[model samples]
Target: MEMRAPEEIEIGQDITPPILPLAFTLSDSSLHSHCSSCFHPLNPKIPKPKPNNSHNPVPIPCNSHCNSSLLYCSHHCRHADADLHVSSGECHLFLQSDTSTWPSELSQLRLALRLFLCFQKLGFLSPEFLVSGRIGGLMSNREKFDIPGRIREGGRIMCLARRMRDGRFGNVVGESATDEMVLCLVLTNAVEVQVSEGRTIGVAVYGPGFSWFNHSCSPNASYRFSLTGFIGEPGSLEPGFRVTPCGEEGTFKAWNGDEDKLTNGSCKYGPKVMIRSIKSIKKGEEVCVAYADLLHPKMLRQSELWEKYRFVCCCDRCNSSPLTYVDRILQQNAANHSTCLDLDHSLCVEEAYRELTDCLDQAITEYMSSGNPESCCEMLEKMLIESSKTEQSQPLEPSPSNFKLHPLHHLSLNSYMTLASAYRIRALDSDSDKDNQLEAFELSRAGAAYSLLLAGATHHLFSSDSSLIAPAAHFWISAGESLMGLVKSSKWSSIIKKSSGFNLSSLLTQRSGKCLLLTELELGFVLRDGFDVVCKGFLACISRISPKVWPFLVHGLPYLKDINDPLDFSWLGMTARHEAQALIGGCECEGVAYIEEETIWKGLVLFALHCLLYGGYLTSVCYGPHCYLIGHVRNLLYGGEGSSLSENVENIC
Candidate 1:
């Protein structure tokens, strides 16, 4: 519960259970569709009852005084929201006595106006309120406000001031001062409240304490909004490890409550926002949350941070690659083009990079426009197939440039990622079409496995940088999800059993050895100048796959745990130690006084290969440990350190 020292936090930790907004408004576009209080879908499951002889349709309140056609999940939410903000006469000023207001009008004015009304209602509207500094010194991007939209926002605030003076918003601060404070508050403290799946619901401001928490690309803390905090048996908490709330003793809810009323959604609590740590924090470490998606490529992350919060991120990920991985690729392509190769059989790396970028970009654009993942997959496959043809037509000359710009480059890896995402979607489709499901299942497995192989060669596991962790995790999660689907569907059960004669142990060993060679080359090419980008990818991959496999590997499904500790197979814990040692050049090979960087990299690669191979084996063996490859790899890695290969194989069989 107290994770001040470096520690591993489990997945789905309830950083913040659903909490009511302190000061919030529904997005103008979403007001008509979502609940005013909970901000969840208004009619997510239930349908409107059809008109009948004995039934009259209840009219939705979309008329006079309610300018926006707002809805709520229940009558309780409607009243709770009204009592909190609306009934305080804040919205009344916008809904004039005679004239109706448009949704756009509300959208433009809501944020600034809410700042005034909420403060006024709370009796904090004095001129000295700004000077007092009690309200955490309202922080906003004053410089960014002045750059582009300052005048426009200034004009809008002035207009709102006039409306307030003329309407029921009685005796708020003077127009100019009000505009200044509101602009500062909106720009600095407001947080976007979106649906759990990512649809923008609205913007809301948290309490001063919540606002003080800073942003980090690689964040240590996170929160989720809810109307009520969850209370259940300690072991039954939703996702994440069971964490005792900071002030609470052993458990959250005492046992005096009724047994039938202990569900997460049925709990009663207040509107305060809760925070939880995503990872361990040292005593002096800054606790930060990502303001944007941490998995985004670096350039995109930086651009959003600057555009939204007006601060350029200097986080480790941002610092590791200022140009972003994609931008660097583009730059490399351009630079390579400047010096054209003159050799007859030289397959120009620059040409391949350019073609791949252009083709993938176009394919992504088409997918975005059409919303068809299948079409996107087809386009990428076609590009790869065509590239294969070109590579065959002109056999590659083994120049450094050719080797650097091989067909199976990082760009090709990106293409594989895209294809994997598409097939994953197809595999998860709820539709009952058996042929489609079978095709999707097969494609998903191939796509995920190929992506993992490509991921291994990308220097993702070369070091323990947090930036690289996310992408690798994303790929592995995709692969694991697809593999789970295959195991459940039993599509490959017969094939797997029939292929028992295949020397899988040799195949895995050979593959892992090749992976190390490819990793050496990639490290030489991309990370020769910098090692910051190395193991972040591998760490991320393990982070994602660990919890998914934990139930099987750690808890061991009622059998293996009887013989082993539940914590013994923690890949994250193992890698964390490995990462720490590698950072300090602690790698030791036999007879070497000090291992060189190259040797250290070789050791790291072999370790990562083992992790990947074991991860795949565990996922596959979850079907039942009778699969022959599992024991082979286990014995190969842990032999003499534990039991013999024959003994382990006998146990499994």
Candidate 2:
């Protein structure tokens, strides 16, 4: 049953026994009835006759004799002896002195009567009072009366009427006599009923300002009802239970499974019940919940718990060093971000296959080096899947029906290309059969790599710059030509797509501008070599194709001054001189061709010096005169002596 406030309450009449008049002798030697402690008159002052024995001891008034001695009849003496009456340490009343201080004897009596009513409400007292001998010449009664109404009106009664009954009143009489009186009254008025079944035990719903309870993560109490055992699975509840009433609802649950498991259980309190740390707390530290999970991280916990609850936490877990805390977090972050490797790197494959496989492995490793571990693992797994498909195809035997290149085919192709280039250069200088076979295999591998690179380049063309396409085209053409020179016809047709399908026209057009510039530079060297080979005459081919190649030659002449190789420059210089003289003889009869003439003359001078810098080989027909012409051209290009051009020319010479 729900505990509710009593609508009405009754107090029985005082059952105190009548005080027997004491015959006492005062200092005057007169016999009189008086209080033993206060020495006050025992009878009311209304009309009692004086005692006949004038020689008896004189009676002293209790009011006049009451002093600092605790034995006196003052309320202070009752307070001093309060500790003796309580069994559980000091009474709550003594601790709450400011609220318990009574303004008068009547007020003190009223509080005591309230306490008696509370005990009666709790069923700790009988309805009838067990009175004893009384003092102050009064008889006391504890029979039934209107307890609630009398208490309500007791505050207005004067001293005579209040003192006429028991010396106790029924109303609080101090400034501090506010809600505590009402709270006590309410508590004492409610009847406690017991429930036998259900998850909930007893619940106390406090009004506003009653949520000041603190929390303990390892709580001291579990919820229990008055009649039933603690509400939980069997064995969860322990005997001899006592609740601290100081923690949060969750805190209680943390201690008991039944309470802990319920989502919207009866225990619904405010954030005040949350327990927060007052200092830094480290991970893995035993966390103590103040108001249960009231406060979270220490930074927030300290500000909130102190500001709201006014308590500082000194728990050991809340005092972790900052450096240690940071290091622990960083370690955790690293662990959470690591990738797991599954494939064994020791697996065997042919040399070409291994090179490609290694490239794929390196790419996978780099991609997974930073980020979430699960993502890195996924990426590496994909790489391994691709590696497995392509690691077996490079041997001399043909592949089976199930064979396929790895999905990470691009990375493998790039690796193959790099290795083939290295082998090709190596084979050019080595004479061993092993080297020759290796070079042949490398050329075939390079052809395959170029095919793969071209496919990727085609896919990237729309998204990337046109310049990127040139490398793919150049490498493919070079590799195809190399494979045609080395491999059998059957293999060449398979690896090299027919030149018809490939857009050679588009490729050549795209390369024309850059090719023209390169050829012009190469031609200047070929001329100094006296046109010994068609390769050296590559510039003449450019000039035959179009006169537009002439401008690139003029632009490249200034850069030739810094060339370090005398032989290379000398070859280039002779080629340039021949080309210039040919252009001059063709255009000399037309005065309108002077602009072309000046460009031809500059190319000639640049080429002549290039030839003279090295040991110029001479023909018998024009040997002496050629040397004289070379010397004359060098002096003119360098400017008169002691000038910047002469200085540069001298440095080169």
Best by lDDT: 1
Question: Which parts of model 2 have CA positions greater than 4 angstroms off?
Answer: 1-410, 423-467, 484-653
**Residue lDDT tens for model 2, 1-653:** 01111122111111111111111111111113322222222343434334653212332222322231112122432232222223211122323323323332222332333333323333323322212211111112212122433433332332212222334444444422222232223222211111211111112222111222223322211111121111242543232201122233443333242322111121121111111221222332322223322112344455554443334655433455542221122111111112223223112223344454564566445543542323332343344344333222232223222222332133433433433343344334332455365544433433333332332222222112221222322333333333323322222333224322222121122222323322222222123223222222332332332232123222322211122221111221111122322321121111112245333322322222222221111111111112232233223323333222221111110
lDDT of each: 0.43, 0.26
Give the per-residue lDDT of model 1 (tens digit) for 1-653.
Answer: 12121234432234333333336677777776766665555544455634441121222342225454656555555555554345433454445442233223344345555555556655555655555322323454554554434534443444454464456354333445555556556656677764332356787776433554567776666654443322332453333322222212222132122222111211122233445554555544555667876444566677887776777878765676344333233233222323346554245654554666788898888876877887887787666654432322233334434323322234566666677667666666622676576665555554444444444433233223333333443344334334434333435444344434222232133232223322332221222312232343333334333233323321312212221221121221112222322231222212211124232222222333435343332222121122223333344334324432222221000
lDDT of 2: 0.26
The TM-score of predicted model 2 comes to 0.15
- Model 1 regions lying over 4 Å from their true place: 1-21, 27-33, 44-67, 83-109, 123-125, 131-136, 147-184, 194-200, 224-273, 296-299, 315-369, 379-418, 424-463, 466-478, 488-653
